[model samples]
Target: MPKPNPANLFHDLPDKLAAELVNILVETPSIRIERIVSTGQCSDAGFWYDQEESEWVIVLKGRAQLCFADGTPPKTLCPGDHVTIPAHQKHRIDWTSASEPTVWLAVFFSA
Candidate 1:
């Protein structure tokens, strides 16, 4: 097998983004890790993400907002803020920074 390599999370970002760029950095049978870069992006209106795996995500740069189906106030996440969403929880991206790219590291795993 080849030796492991190193990658910079912030390197080689897109210049003009029509949509969020998602890169799967690692994957296993029960787990997946992704690096997502969003620029002024949000979920489609009336849309919600219902995933079978639990997710833990952290913003690495810029900012983002998330809204849940339970009617709680939207949550704003900054560079270091993180959240854990259980499987089947309905959530949506309410907003992302328009001035800069919002880098997110998301880990999805089986409960």
Candidate 2:
């Protein structure tokens, strides 16, 4: 016997501002599969993720702004933009827009 593999899926948002989660992998104990997110009017605020893990993220479409807690100016990102949030690094989504949908692929894992 063997496990079945599902086909690729696509998700569309209803409003001009929305987030569609394409997929999520959960194997546990090691690196997870991946998370595909589509967003509009998203923002990174004054909090943080991955307190016990690290995150690798990339922009697949549209644009966004990444705000850091170190007083650094927000960084603009578009298609093909990538960033890694280190463990315990506080950050947020500075801004996003509805004109264009922002797509992101994120990988999270602990070390």
What are the TM-scores, per candidate, against the unseen true structure? Answer: 0.92, 0.69
Clashing pairs in 2: 43-93, 44-92, 44-93, 44-94, 45-92, 45-93
Best by lDDT: 1
Per-residue C-alpha lDDT of model 1 across residues 1-111, encoded as one tens digit per residue? 954444989887665589999999999999999999998999999999999999999999999999999887789999999999999989999999999899999999997
Model 2 ranges off by over 4 Å: 1-22, 44-50
The window of 10 residues in a row where model 1 has the poorest summed lDDT is: 2-11
Report the number of clashing residue pairs per model: 0, 6
The per-residue C-alpha lDDT of model 1 at residue 75 equals 90
lDDT (Cα, tens digit) per residue for candidate 2, span 2-95: 5544532224533353444546655577676564554565543445443577878888776788777767677788878888778777677766
Model 2 gets an lDDT of 0.65
Q: What is the C-alpha local distance difference test score of each model? A: 0.93, 0.65
lDDT of 2 at 95: 66
